[model samples]
Target chain A: MRLNLGLKTLSIFTALLLVAACETAPTETGDSSGGGATTQTSGSGSTTTVVTETKTTTVQPGSQEDLVLNVGDRVFFGFDKYDLSDEAQATLQRQAAWLKANPTVTLLIEGNCDERGTREYNLALGERRATAVKNYLVTLGVSADRLSTISYGKERPVALGHNEAAWAQNRRSVSVVN
Target chain B: MIGSVQKIRTLLAGLVLAIALASVARAELVIDITQGNIEPMPIAVTDFYADNEATAKIGKQMADVIRADLERSGLFVPIDPRAYLQQPKDLQVTPVFANWRKIAAQALSTGLVRALGDGQINVQFRLWDVFAEQYLTGIQFTTPPSNWRLTAHLIADAIYKRLTGEDGYFSTRVVYVSESGPADRRIKRLAIMDQDGENHQFLTSGNELVLTPRYSPTQQVLTYLSYFNNKPRVYLYNLDTGQQEILGEFPGMTFAPRFSPSGNQVVMSMAQDGNSEIYLMDLRTREMKRLTNHPGIDTAPSFSPDGTQITFESDRGGRQQIYIMDADGSNVRRISFGSGNYGTPVWSPRGDLIAFTKLTGGKFSIGVMRTDGSQERILTEGFHNEGPTWAPNGRVLMFFRQIPGKNDGRSDKVSLWSIDLTGYNEREVITPGDGSDPAWSPPYNLNR
Candidate 1:
């Protein structure tokens, strides 16, 4: 009877160890998820959360959803164009105001292109688009150091379709609160 | 011990006998296949004979792969096996050339597979000109059971080389981007496959975006662009070692990378502060040089076969066009004066012509022209077609074709397609998912 009780305790210990291992494995491999949140549950029915927050707390005033809700996160462009239209200019004005209101918020402006052009040319055009937005924001008094930019070219198309409508939507610049 | 010894002796005797029979087969007649008709050569591939049950399965599989490879090349038509008059065993002993000619088959291929214990297989095949009653070529390969498909490809290469008087591209592979998922969250991974779309494997996970994978000329190394850490940079990946490292930590984005002919340097475009220009980096000394100092975009550089000149696309002339320059980035001259914007210019391995993607009349097409931009011919046109890569022999070009999705815009498919150098025999290269940016490797034996 005593031996049976000891075996049961050892198996229970092993089960707890496995649970702990699974919980930790995702944190190491899930770097793209950004937040890298780790949840731990105690054996006594209590819960603990260990979140390894990196690069988001200082510059991001609130959650991403909150930023997208309060201010626009994207601006669209015309076909094969990096120059801003009237609509794009107005959107950038609003984005500039948002940046002014949130002083601590840093921005990452991602430039994207439609899938209709060459990959290398699209990258250059995307950079032009992002730079256009950044220049306009600078004129509105946002510090250039607080804003960084990257162009994804046609590699990251928001629209999967080959139609003009999808391509129109894919050519845009998005602002992400770091 | 005696039984094992006897088995070894029997195998040796069989090898010697096969060699003797092959020499006799060669003495029958000689057919010059150099001037065959423009139409595909009609061939019959018999099922390979097997020595055992396990080998029988592999033998049938290998023959199927070989037949598919030949047929997909658009140079040969594989006659249906059901129309074959004799069994595989009978053909292995001796192919009745008159029977194949009677069935309208100009070429006949027969083979045998033997199990050499310990999971080894011996594959022997012969290509015969049925009308001329001559053996074109015969080869034997021994490999592990798992590598039976490669053995079949090697046989197909032998047949192709013997018939065409050109190096066979069958033994090479293509590196491309496999795209999946919805448009907004599309996942692109680096993938490689045999030239015939066999032995497909993904080299990278979709967690990071990768593009434009180009194989090295002398090694199993690939140079490509990856958006890792949100920094778009050039990276080198070794196929044999499964190790990858960023080519350099440039202060800006680097894209459109291609390896030099010697695989000792990489040429790509680096964009910073709204300008993109061509740059070259020597892998050995980590030395970086600016190849082009244009304010406009200069990218998609390809080295000539001799590595003395580079052909690339640039918009410095107010519109996108093809340009050529010396290895040190001097004597820049425009090579494209067509009606459309030209980009993604790839110099053929033969170093005589350049393949490029043209955008005109609101459509995209793949075309080729002389290095001096003469005798321009558009190969294929569609809604979206780009990224033309050449086969190892420089006789064929492969690119991606993107078909429009439905009204909901959900099922868009991008597939790889190949075309002959003369702009004939266009065919789709099948892949498991959407593929783009295909770069063909040099022939497998070139480095050796």
Candidate 2:
């Protein structure tokens, strides 16, 4: 029974992740272009020259921007568990490929937790999550020297909901180019 | 206990108007605090007698502060002074027992403030049992004119100890993280204030994230986790000098710091390769010893009162549970067997119980249990409550409760709250902003 429930939750979580990624990707581009147009309109004669720099249009291969936009720089974890899920492993595999392409790029893996755990315990759990991602990248032939990790505990969350959906998003690890 | 005098700065004599032998028996008019529920004793706090207007204002202020201190303890209720038939002048000689009794006051507190030639103040106070019409306890304090608040706290402590037979926690301060901003980008600053939430001062500028500040035995130093320069490590903060330095260099992230009972050592967790283990560091020699070699997380270690045992939370048993080990990391034993996850186990100052945060069925609870994990009792439960810290007296526990915001959880309000050991008298300790991880300081013991 427990295994069935776990599988059901995982499926729902994967569906939610797809919806969230789709919703956020366009919003990010739209906000940047909207901000650019506002800034140009405030100037004397640059309103017509305002250009929307979309993520795909200005993508640089092997760059941090490209890693975030194309390869997916983040991997989510289950509550209180640092072991990577199947989907998380796939994301890390993509991230490892990107890092292997960008041989000169070093990364910082930031581990984060949901608000459900205690602060001190969450700090340790976050480190584990970050280490899990770093280990996967290392297994994929990434150099250990090129990776560093830190846990932000539950102090930072990307979602603002009190439900399971927000918590699933908050409990994640993000590989940032340093 | 009645004859005890706490003299500070100067040993000026504490005047005794009348030493009635029967007062000793009347002092037995005590409140049984071990029980969870009890009515607050009605006591009258009259303004202290002063000869001039300048001293009169200080006298009134001291009385007001004393009244607030006693009332906040949840043991006593300072009766309204307007119904007093006698003025401050009546306390100059003795409180007329008949007048105090008419207002239904079971106890009465009276005092006098005098300015000395050396620009200091001499404050003396007496607690009287109205039903017995006898003096219970009294003390005299000589301090600088600017320290009237501390003097008032001392007087309240004396009265509290006399009536309840337990050491008072009023003369202590609390160190906690003052939180503000939204959830994702919250800015937390190290803040300290009197136990009553007065005399608040922020120790950190909130530039770096700080958490879980624990006071040293001397109360002059603090060990906490800070993301200073973006490195999450344990750092030592000197309270007096406003100086901070990272603890000894470690291989990985060091966090969940707590000082030993003697304040000469610190126990914390250092994470390497994602595995955290408890380690002890001596301040004098900077020697480090790894205590736990578990692959699972073991952190938040707190010392037993005698420094002989350490209680912490670990997940080595496939889930988070409370565990106990000797001071030297020997004799490791798991104590908690309940179904829920247990974390942040803090030993009581009195050495009888360990307070912890328990999460079961998505509800968080602040609870306590015996050192052996027997007689588990939940004190308070809510949507999100964690990090239980004990008061200096061991009679109360302080922790933070996070409530969802009206619109969203991003703007949730996290506030510090305190509750007695009996699971009653839960009161919010109001701060200027959101507060968390409150650690109570040892009694100042100013006169010791």
**Cα lDDT of model 2 by residue, B187-270, tens digit:** 899999999999999999998899999999865899999988778999999987899999988768999999999999999999
Chain A TM-score for candidate 2 is 0.72
Q: What is model 1's DockQ versus the real complex? A: 0.22
Clash count in backbone of candidate 2: 0
- lDDT tens digits by residue: candidate 1, B1-448: 0001011223223643565456653543322333323577788888789988888898888889888888877788899999988778997755887789878988888888898876677777877778767666677766667777777777787778877767778878999999987554568899999998878999999878898999998888999999887788999999988898998878888888998998899998888887888888999997889989978788889999999999999888888999999989999999999887999999999999999999998899999999999999899999889999999888889999988765233466789999888777788889999899999998875214
lDDT of 1 at B401: 92
Clashing residue pairs, candidate 2? none
TM-score, B chain, candidate 1? 0.91
Question: lDDT winner among the candidates?
Answer: 2
lDDT of 1 by residue, A1-178 (tens): 2353244233223222232333223322121111112123222122112111222333344434334434556677888777888877877887888777778888878888987788878988898788878888898889999888899888665444455655665688877666
Q: TM-score for candidate 2, please give it.
A: 0.91
- Show where candidate 1 strays beyond 4 Å: A1-76, A85-98, A158-166, B1-37, B92-94, B117-119, B446-448
Residue B415 CA displacement from its true place in model 1, Å? 1.5
